[model samples]
Target chain A: MKFSPLVDELIKSLQCLPGVGPRSAQRMAFHLLERDRNGGGKLGDSVSRAMSEVGHCQQCRTFTEQELCQICSNPKRTESGQLCVVESPADLLAIESAGQYSGQYFVLMGHLSPLDGIGPDDIGLDRLETTLSEGEWREIILATNPTVEGEATAQYIADIAHDCDVKVTRIAHGVPVGGELEYVDGTTLALSFSGRTAV
Target chain B: MKFSPLVDELIKSLQCLPGVGPRSAQRMAFHLLERDRNGGGKLGDSVSRAMSEVGHCQQCRTFTEQELCQICSNPKRTESGQLCVVESPADLLAIESAGQYSGQYFVLMGHLSPLDGIGPDDIGLDRLETTLSEGEWREIILATNPTVEGEATAQYIADIAHDCDVKVTRIAHGVPVGGELEYVDGTTLALSFSGRTAV
Candidate 1:
């Protein structure tokens, strides 16, 4: 009923992936062992190589092979001192895919979680302060998600920006563009009404 | 807008997993890089080791490190001449988890997909024929799925069984337990009616 030791290890390691439970992990292991060893090998190599090579960008804290992330290193992104602060690298990627934000980024990598003992220091808040103190940015955009923790993190960063004499702005919070009013939650509806602007 | 070359390769390779798409692949890659690099390394090592060391069982074509799979090598499993043929190792694991079957297994890996250029040999059917010719089995259970390709594969194997003077049996096709009749499809209904038992 159990797999061999090597298979078991692979399955166990797969559980580290978000949303993958034991059953799915087992399925992934069996799929690799049975059908596509080459793919599995490539995946393994990539994981190891990337993990060893990739580190936080010295400037923005996003993952990068070099000292600074590509975005932070680019000369074209520096003209506008409009910086976007996001909760994680994935969030940074989402904004990058939009292709509209030419501003640079600062990745928090995690939100402030007081209950879990994750303080500002845990999420590179000190580094963010050092970046803010440089006084290069004219405007800072808080693009964290609309969760309670995200809001708290934005407020904390906003206060820091005010201290540095930088203008701070929060991304809009409302019903999503394609979302139906009937299905939108109460808080979002209230925020939409409160944050509404002239058409 | 684009990940570095190493990050991009990792994202692409993670897509080799079943049900993972581009977005999820990126999420997985970031998870490994940011949170669980040690786990990622272990997963990579396990995948490489499993792929290189594991090969098809000489007896049943299931994955194994040795010449024969654990089931085939076990003395307790050899007493019965019942062989359950399935489409993939995942299916074999499903049956083994049920803990009722006392016999062995044969993993076909895939069904006869003529459209995809997968013939009998593609699923190791020749090896199956050779095993059938040995005349060791009292009954061969065709436990392939009920899809069209699966049915064709089972029928083709049944003919081979008939030629070898071995009895062939198909697993029952019935309304699933706890399923409502109103939602059961037509073909399933027909098969359930035709295969109804005295109970």
Candidate 2:
């Protein structure tokens, strides 16, 4: 009636991934069994090792197997005296890929959502405050997502940064580059108008 | 600039799954590392175990950890004197889910593809021939997909079954039961008309 017990278990366990459902899980399991056994074995080992070994970097709260993440440990990154606060490691990577900012980052791991009972300390804001106070940073950039929770998180961290005598700035919100104004949402259009430059 | 070595490797390894690209791989890796380490660990163990232990069923060629799959091992399944041939385990599962077929199955694992150099043996047709010649089936049902290669494969197997002195039947091709006539493609519509059964 169903796949063998081990196959069924593999399919079920694969559903734990984000956006994967029963059908996708089945396809993935079959794909591994039928086509790419070597890749599957490697995936299994890598996932196991990463799960057991990877931990949060003590300095920036980003994922790493070491005491500090690569970016956090780099002295050149600290010389910029600018700290970018992001909700997750993915967000940090997005900013890093832009190749514009060379400052250090502090990963929140998640934004504050009081309705869900998540508070500042839950997102590692206390640690952010400690870093802001101890480090000779000239500016703290709030680079969290533009969502309500991300905004609230940024504001809370901004207040903490102000108390630590660091100038706080939020990333500018506006129409994305190469975006057509006609297709832009009302809220984003309004923000673009309000935040427009003199040029 | 990049994730830690372990994290990077996890992301890359995760991409081995079908339909997963770089972005999805990164998301999966981070999700496992951040929120579902327990699930990730379980998935790792399950995948590893399945890859190492699961092998083709000696009788039906479906994936199994045992010499014979459940259906092949069941005495009652052989009572119908019918064997359904399908392209993959997923197809077998689909037919089984319909609850209409109690007959045994022969999983081809893939259809015949000459351009890609996949011969009959590559899809285990040689094994299928052995089964067809040895089993006491009154009829062999060809349930391969309606695609070009699948149809060719079904035709080839039908010939083999005929040579083995067993009656062969192909599952009827037509518009799907719930699909709208206007939305159905020309080939399916034509098949539906041609394959219509009189009340």
Model 1 regions more than 4 Å off: A33-35, A175-199
Cα-based lDDT at residue B154, candidate 1: 98
Interface RMSD against the true structure, candidate 2: 0.6
Best by TM-score: 2
Model 2 scores a C-alpha lDDT of 0.93
Cα lDDT of model 2 by residue, B82-142, tens digit: 9999999999999999999999999999999999999999998898888989878889999
TM-score for chain B of all predictions: 0.94, 0.97
lDDT of model 2 at position B39: 100
Worst 10 residues of 2 chain B by lDDT: B128-137
lDDT of 1 at B169: 97
| DockQ score of each predicted structure, in the order shown | 0.61, 0.88
Tens digit of lDDT per residue, candidate 2, span A42-144?
A: 9999999999999999999999999999998998998889999998999999999999999999999999999999998899988888888887988999999
